[model samples]
Target: MQQPLAPWLEPTLNKLLAQAHEGQLAHALLLPLSKEQGAEVLLNRLLQGLLCLNGNACGQCKSCHLLAAGTHPDAYSIKADGNQIKVDQIRELTSALSKTAQQGGARVAIIWQAEQLNHAAANALLKTLEEPAANCFIVLASAKAGLLPATIRSRCQNVALTQVSKAQSRDWLQNQGVDWNTVGWTYDVLGGPYAMLQQQGQERLEQLQSARKEWSNALAKGQVSATLCQYTQDQPADSLHVLHWLISKKMGSILASQRAFANRLSALISEISQVRQQLAHMPSVNYVALCTRLVLDYQQAAKQ
Candidate 1:
């Protein structure tokens, strides 16, 4: 079933629906999700609106029924298999798109995490995006659009989802009875309350707090190995995000003598950013080694 759209997103949806009504809807779209937004949720909502008999995705029509059942002939989705979206996937999609809609209604295709598309895959898909099928809407969504190939991006209209105010996000989450402890770290990874809701539980909250403290103490005492050891394969990305946010936040508290290390700090930030990219996009990486090297590098840089 389609979920309710976030309030902050309503305005954006309204604008797009208006364009859709006016017959100005672009066949191809590149949407970069706001930090902390659910990429899947946004994609589904957009697809719902596109496929919905009514502009609002009323969820009671034949189209909505097919969509909910995952058997909609005109509805298509492309997602990463493991870490990459292969060329074959794009080929299959393009082939299917060439055909007429089975239900004789609007057709919609959404590529989630489009940055995961490999070179061949992106190029293959770019051709179709340049001249998409009539009555078909293709939406490409990613957390970072820059990671996608320039050619593929050039052919799509861009829609960047911006973050709502922290206060507004807090109120919304509260209304949902969400139990996101700290509430602030909900902003980590550009995630919002809905994302943090997945991490609820006093036990999980305590674990996160302990990890954050460990990260802080490790940096202070130069316990790089021990801190790096804390990162598990199951949640390496989340752990790294917390540590990065913590380190960045504590950078301002450096001693006056360490103020001259600003350049080094900036460099470490860039390195952390690169590491994040690696952890997210590269498959089969030894995260332990990567985390250890990154933390030790930051320590050495801070001392210099």
Candidate 2:
């Protein structure tokens, strides 16, 4: 067999290979792995092995070398640039799938963050999944499997990559020469082996932490509306956390919960959903403005 790539994924790799070896593999494989779980690396390696001409997982084969060089003709990958995976991209992939494999073997297509597909794109891809070509494989990787269509999910073999032990991850990082001081919270932030080695700038993490703190303080001060809006706008991505924090704080005040805090939390949660819906429609919305409004509204509701 070809030398194992990503020894950490050897078990999963072996399981998949055994299926392939038995000629009982499914056309679609849904790998629901977290961002830091090294899902992408596993996806690439799996495709490489499938495409290897020797049918033996040989990394030294001509096809394997092409994959290492990032020039594999039969392997394709798609990822969202900013927003959703557009219908055109899926259409193109579907058309490409119709053609015979360049290596005259397996045709592999991978979609990163596949759940980011918009309604139209999802529909476009559904047709292909329903009637895939012979010797073709589709891999969809996402952190949130709930976001994908149930129909699509039901058709694939779902493989969830769970969190590895923190001690094991830390040990692996040390072996990789990661500087813990400079990379403080990297483990908590990235969550695994695939994400540990990534270099993040000191300032960005600090800025996000500062924003979270400031937002927390403002909520405690009973600031509602405009000020809350400002905080939300400044940290749009953290909107979910901000709302959750408010709910947690209010939960302690049973009297407050009885008074009106519960209603406020409910309303804020609804508003948060609306904000996400709006963002899905118009991604260019002012993040600061949106977040500020949400925070302020929740603050006002809590006081009642």
Candidate 3:
């Protein structure tokens, strides 16, 4: 059985359905979603609604069956080959979209992580975005929509998904049999209900909490602990996120009385962000040294 649409996503789905009902749905849609949101669930619901013969995603129709079986000729999904979506992938998509829908209904194409589309692939998709075929819909879903070229973003209708509130997320997690008290901090770090749930079972919450405590103790002692350094080395991305959160929290607490110290913390936070960006785009960058430098910087700020 298909899961129901997430409570937070229901409104967006309703709006899209209403648009489709009025034949006012755009040819291209840009969905900016974070990991915390139920992007996959929303995407599935949207596609089914568009492809369903009854216009309601009834799940009983032949079109729904084809979609469920992943054999729907008119529905196409594009994903990054590795870190990037190549020009060839976009070319193949355009070729398939040029043909009429085999099911004689709306043809839907979804590009997951559309921000990962390389320059050539993005360029190739421009013409299709500018002039789509009849009954064709292109959906570009990206966690970092700003990374996509302005030209591509300008051509598509931006659909902003509703962010789930902390109260709503806590209630939902509790309903799912999760112990909110134990996993609440995970939610704070991830800022997404779905992401928190995914990481909960993997014991990431415990690791992060431990790291936070260790870092706090080290900050108090005016030194970076070897264990904390090891943790950062092991999990560079998670460590950086935790570090950012910790420094931000510290900065906020001291912003009123310790302006100079807070300013230093703020600078360290900015440097951490730069290191994160460097690691993301340039994997060969020396993250270990960067992480150590950030920790030392945090210690210096704490001493002041």
Candidate 4:
């Protein structure tokens, strides 16, 4: 029989369970999950199972019931307020950890979008990380690890989760009662299950497809200013993906196209890399303006 969670969950949970079984689980862990993977749900189940008095998640004990009800006193969470995680939030979380475990079981702290932690917040978190409490576990979930501070990153055991194959995603969608035919743009835009659910349904998918087509066409025409303003309105997080795709396409065309644009492909690739690097620090920059400038710079580079 299929497990309660996604198939990919097995490899990750199994590794953790084995470690916990052998009493080797580290105090802190960093789970870098792909954009589409449901890290939150998986972590919940893992925590519930970990806290259950029984070896298995009987879902009957007080701990399991509290977890299912989302009232587990030992479980803590911190998420980005806007583009950044403030220092105050980190302080609050650390203070919460100082208190003894509510049920005298393992205490857990989960940080969502860990890459959003600013310098001060990250530093504050590092203090607790350097000296974790006994029987306490800290789980930081991130879409990408490079955005995090190197100091904080070095302390945690890193677990990377990649995108599930297209076939696996398609099958999962089918099981969720979604027809593959209806998944045209949603599937492509989301790249996996959680995103599919977030961006699902009829009207939204249509809008995404329309936005993508228009953006692609404008980008190809070297109309940078108009495209930038348009993207400012849509504000899709996949802008980096679009830039990379365009660069790849232009590079592939270099061998055959007599378009007479000398070193144009090379310039585009350079600009894309710079913009992508900048995107990782969005908390510190005016993101909309930066995106506009990136498009303008890319167009200027192409013309040269």
Candidate 5:
């Protein structure tokens, strides 16, 4: 059985289903979501609802069964190839959309990480977006919708998925039999309930704890540790994010006499942000080197 939608996402799903039933659903929808949101779960429920023969995801109909089994011929998906969605992938999806639905019902297509669509891929999809086939719907999901082409954005109806509040998240986590006190810092660093849940295994928690200790020691000794470098090298983006959070927290506790040190910490945080941006756009960048440089800079900053 499929898991229920997160408390925060249920309303959005219901609204979309209502629109579909009223024949007011747009041909193209753009869903902008943050990393902590459960985009896949919401998308699965939306697809099942849209393709269900009964106009509701009853889960008893043949369409629902096929979707559950991942054999729904009318359902199609496009994903990034490595770091980009190429033109050929878009071409194939368009060709598939042009064909009749194998189940003689609505056809649905989902483009995951839509922001990763390359220039040519975005151009290739415009015709289909403007002239969708009868009973066809296209859904584009992206964390960075601003990276998508203006033409693509203009052609689609926007669907905003809001983040869950901290209080709501804490309540949900408690209901799941988790102790929020243990994972609260992880949640703060990750900034989402789902992200915290996904990343908060005992082993990961230990690694983060160890990294924090090493960071403090490095600051006092004015030298970065091998363990700290390894942690950053293993997951460069996440490590940098954690480091950024740590620096901000440390800055808050600095004495008024340490204003110069706080300023240095602020500069280090900005540098980490820039490195993170580079990693996101250029996956091939030497992350190991970047991690070393960031940790080294932090060590120097601590020397005041």
Candidate 6:
């Protein structure tokens, strides 16, 4: 079920709902891709509104109940099955759209991490986006929209969202009774409280911090390969994200550090980015070995 929109996003929601009410809503709506915003919740809110019977989503209608149960015959979600949204998934969605909605109402599809659509998958989906099905609405949101094909992006109506101010985020967190340090770290690491809490919770703070420090020490000591192999060789999918977040968190400061440090960190970040792309797009990836190899490559490149 979709949660209520945050105060900061209510305006955007209202604007879209207005368009929807007017029958002028685009078949595809591209929400903010930034981590600072919860685009999914916004999209869900819009979908709930569309499904509501009384124009106002009282959370008491049959459609609302179905949505809450995730059995909304008309609503579907497309997200990463493993690491990518494959062509088959897109095809399934298309087929589903071609049929009349089970409830004989609108057809809605939410594409989470739309940027992760593989080339073939994206191409296949592009045709549908360009020539939308009747009463079909697609919502695509991603922090890495830049990675999506220009053509696919062009077909959607963009919903612009600005980052929430720090003061506002702080107040929100305080109201929620989040401790000061977590609020601070969440802001620093994840860009805002909402993203931070979603990405990392209080229970994970200590372990994540320890992991980050160990990786940093390894990076500094030129032990990248060994460090990655030790911690990531068994579960690279999970390990790599933790490692990546740690490195990503420090990249800004690294870029501003001394010349040698900046050069090395830049090289390391590049290697991480390349491997991350491969992990996302390629099938049958040896996640553990790939991460280890990338770390080794980063070490060599960083030395240059």
RMSD in Å for candidate 1, one decimal?
4.4
TM-score of each: 0.75, 0.64, 0.83, 0.68, 0.85, 0.68
User: Over 4 Å off in model 5, which ranges?
Assistant: 1-4, 254-261, 278-304
Cα lDDT tens digits for candidate 2, 53-159? 87665878888888888898888888885788999999999999899888778888999899999999989989998997888999998878889999989889887
Candidate 6, residues 1-304, lDDT tens digits: the string is: 2343567878888888788788899999887656556666777788888777664666898888898888998898898989999999999999998899877667888888999999899999999997898778988878788888999989999888856777777677666666656446435545466665564455445545655665666656655545455555444444555666666665566666656756666666676667656665666765446654655655665656
Task: Show the lowest summed lDDT stretch of 10 residues, model 6.
Answer: 231-240
Q: Which candidate, 2 or 4, has the higher TM-score?
A: 4
**All candidates' lDDT scores?**
0.75, 0.71, 0.85, 0.72, 0.82, 0.72
Pairs of residues clashing in candidate 1: 35-190, 36-190, 36-191
Which segments of candidate 2 are over 4 A away from where they belong?
A: 1-8, 179-185, 200-304
Number of the candidate with higher lDDT, 1 or 2: 1
**Candidate 1 lDDT, tens digit per residue, 183-256?**
55746653676566555565655556766776677677766554446554556766777777776765666735
> Against the correct fold, how does model 2 do in TM-score?
0.64
Tens-place lDDT per residue, model 4, 1-304, is 1124777776887778678657788888998756567676577666876677673567898887887788989888899988899999999999988889887777888898899999999999999999988878888988877899889889999875645777887787778776777554456545667677666566656555555665566556645455555564455455555555555666677646644453665666676667666655665556456555655665675666
Q: What TM-score does prediction 5 earn?
A: 0.85
What does each candidate score in C-alpha RMSD? 4.4, 6.4, 3.0, 5.7, 3.2, 5.7
Model 1 accuracy (lDDT, Cα): 0.75
